[model samples]
Target: MKIAFYGSSLVSAYWNGAATYYRGLLRSLAEKGYEITFYEPDVYDRQKYRDMEPPDWCKVVVYEGTIDALKAAARQAAEADIVVKASGVGFQDDRLLEEVLGNASPRALKIFWDVDAPATLAELKSDPDHPLRQALFKIDLVLTYGGGDPVVNAYRSVGAAECVPIYNALDPQTHHPVPEDSRFAADLGFLGNRLPDREARVEHFFLDPASRLPGRRFLLGGSGWQDKPMSSNVNYIGHVPTRDHNAFNVTPMAVLNISRASMAENGFSPATRVFEAAGAGACLITDHWEGIELFLKPDEEILVARDGQDVAALIAGLSRQSAARIGARARMRVLADHTYAHRAREVDEIFRARLGARMEAAK
Candidate 1:
């Protein structure tokens, strides 16, 4: 099958948290013998800032021009067996949504894949006419990163014709254990963009614990974090590229997973870091969130913290051997049930089912 997907930068993780997610899903799809053409806007010098080059699995097309003038690309997208418009395309997502929907082939399975399901559903509650909100029922399927009843019900209430949760999963080939790099070595490590929804959680779960252990070296990576004041024990390695994720994960004695407020509250919304940290064989300590046990067995495969005090206690008591055991178990869990190959198969089944239904309706 041929697919056309338009999303955030596939080459750069800079300011684009969805880059890893896109890569994992697309790579898996291509491995399944599907032809894919990925479209990304040439904004923010993403091509120049890219840390990884596009793989041979599919074609990468970068477009530069107004949304209206980009209709020619939409025409090409219409020819694919499936066309996807992922959430947060960096800019002009509303216009792109309208154009892509308008140009979709009558027989193609056109989908709106919402990577940030919580934020989208929450906003739709307040503004029903939120561009994409109006197009939900018209789209053949709505794929999401968040799972569980809360996320599913929210999408249904918003008039989504059908919704499926394709949660984040590990790409073992890209994220497996690697030799630690001294530049990233630390007692604690965290990589994430500094957004309003997550900054407070980072303070509560990561920074506060770092402060409690004044002698322990803590390393923070990712952009938009330099503006914040940090503790003396904390080290800031600004904007570690995607290529260094394995080294970054392994270099830390243990890595932290702090979920954004919306994702945490909704449950079953594991961020890309959770799997990446474990896939690299790094012990993980995450904040308390509902439905976490479904993914990782806390106190066994992983550790959970309620607050800064809990995090400090866990850090103080965890032994090297225990940490290594936990990391190993977590990695084993993801390798068996939570890889891109697993999720890609699920997506393929959903696409076939949706396409069949569309065919029936046409007949």
Candidate 2:
């Protein structure tokens, strides 16, 4: 099966969270005998911050961010078995959706893969001028990275013929335990970019904990956090490479996972970091979310923090042996049930089911 993706910069991981997800998913799919092509609008700066070079597993085409380039992408999509347009393409080229729907072959299944389901739904609900609303019905299927049953039903209500959640998964090879590095080694570490909607949660969950534990070392990584005033005990490592993630995860006594506004609002949405941290055998302390137990068994495989005080207490109280035990359990669970290979198989099943339904309808 030939599958093509139209989405944000897959070739760039600098300030690009979705790129890590895409690379892992597509790479796993490629390993499963699916021919894959990724179409990304060449945002020139990406060349400088490229993390993983285009692997031999798939063909990657970078086009100029223009109507002409989108037209070219549509032409390329015409030959694929499946063409997926993902959210957060980072450019204002809504016309690409039109060209893909208009140009793809009959056998080609067009999918709108929403990485940010809650944000997309909220925007569509509030903004009548949203360009993607009209295009939703035209796509053959809608797939989301997160958001549970409610999100799928809502997408169907908005005219998606089918909606599926292909939640985030770990890439075991890329994110496994590593020896600690002094630079990243911390009592607690939080790695996420700053967003206004998430600022309050970060303060309540992360910052407050750091302040409470004045003697313990805390670390903050990711972009847009340079200017944020952190306590003196908090170390700020701006934008660690995806390759360095495993070491970063393993170095910490416990890693922190904080959801954005959309993810927090839409429960069951575990970010890629959660799985990545688990894969690295890192004890993870995440802010409370419903359905977290469905992924990682709370209090057994992972720790949950309801607020900053909870975070501080967990860090201060847990012995190293206890932290290691939880981390090991979490890593085992994810490796068995939540790896990229598992996700690729799930996607393959979804594709087969869609095709089978189409065949049955025709007959």
> How well does each candidate superpose onto the true structure, as a TM-score?
0.97, 0.96
Q: Which stretches of candidate 1 lie over 4 Å from their true place?
A: 360-363
Please list the Cα RMSD from the true structure of every candidate, rounded to 1 decimal place. Answer: 1.3, 1.5
Model 1: colliding residue pairs: none
Per-residue lDDT for 292 in model 1?
90
**For residue 262, what is the lDDT in candidate 1?**
91
Q: lDDT scores for all predictions?
A: 0.87, 0.87
Per-residue lDDT value at 38 in model 2: 91
Off-target runs (Cα >4 Å) in candidate 2 are 359-363
What C-alpha lDDT does candidate 2 achieve relative to the native structure? 0.87
Model 1 worst lDDT run, 10 consecutive residues: 65-74
Candidate 1 TM-score over all chains jointly: 0.97
lDDT of 1 by residue, 4-103 (tens): 9988888888888888899998899998889999888888778779988778997988787567446766777778889999998876888888888888
Q: After superposition, how far is residue 207 of candidate 2 from its true place, in Å?
A: 1.3
